[model samples]
Target: MTTDGPPARRLMRWRNAVWLAAAVLFLLNFVQRGIDLFSIILTAIVVALGFAVEHVETQTRRPFKNYLRVALASFALGLVLVAMPLLMGAGIWIGLILWAGLSGAALFWCTYYERTEPR
Candidate 1:
């Protein structure tokens, strides 16, 4: 036999839904407020993925320095590009788009180079 929930059970369902919605909204606001930090994180993750193409773990113990340098330089370049009058004047959205596109291109180039020209 199928069982239908009682009134209290139905309320429990609504309670869970409310909690989930609250959590989602909170996360959305948090991300919106820290977009710059998120952008940097995205760049770092892409750089790390590029390095993964060559099995970064197999490299020398000192390779971390090189990887860190590349990630930092990429992040700095992204910030500079976003801050330029050309992009900034376009609007914040445009600047963010440009930053993402540049970061992706840089990461892809890194991956391609590592794949074809092993050290």
Candidate 2:
């Protein structure tokens, strides 16, 4: 079911905070270790997806906007992960492919939810 109100806003804030924390950790990992950490990248990807999926706006829900947001966030996160020195070349292609697939899936999900959701 769709959600809004204070609880959803709180959840959105919490998710964004988590994403920021994960992003900070990711940057620090690179700076300190001078190398890419797979785990940190994975954390970032998960955090980004989690934050995007919260869909916390109080106004009329817009699935297309959500799809765009998810797509951009996924691409940004995927770009960061694959651009690391450790995972280059094939990783670049893989990351882009994954981003496209994820965006498409998110669009499908958002459309489906919009139709099935109680209005």
Candidate 3:
């Protein structure tokens, strides 16, 4: 086997490892170069814009909500991506602020969204 774990559990282990690696890299990047509002906004904008590619790949007309979702995420993240760097210095602190903002927005959204709605 290419991996050490059992075949059934290998995928999960790799996924967890990838997550850990991402966390470490994020920390390191924050400590070194900084939050990089431009980079984060650019990354988020690019990701959101990628919905066009997703649409093409799926070859299905999605609902308006999908477009709205993409737009809102881009606008919001881009806003936070800019604000955090300005509010906090260009350091790990910006990362913390961004994380807090995102978490708060998520929880706020969750509180209003219908819990009964199927995932």
TM-scores for every candidate against the unseen true structure: 0.36, 0.42, 0.31
Expressed as tens digits, the lDDT of each residue in 40-90 for candidate 1 is 665565545545533433443433534544566566666666655454465
Stretch of 10 with least lDDT, candidate 1: 53-62
Which regions of candidate 1 fall more than 4 Å away from where they truly are?
Answer: 1-69, 82-90
The number of the candidate with the highest TM-score is 2
lDDT of candidate model 2 versus the reference: 0.65
Which candidate number maximizes lDDT? Answer: 2
Model 3 lDDT per residue over 5-118, tens place: 786477657656865775676678668877888667655554555555444434544344444454456455655676556555665566556766775676556545535445
Residue range 1-119, candidate 2, lDDT tens digits:
76566786777687678778877887787788776567666666666665555543333256656656666666666666555533544546666666678767876887787788765
Against the true structure, candidate 1 reaches a TM-score of 0.36
Ranking by lDDT: 2, 1, 3
lDDT of each: 0.60, 0.65, 0.58
Give the lDDT of residue 77 in candidate 1: 62
In model 3, the worst 10-residue window by lDDT is 56-65
Misplaced by over 4 Å in model 3 are 1-6, 42-119
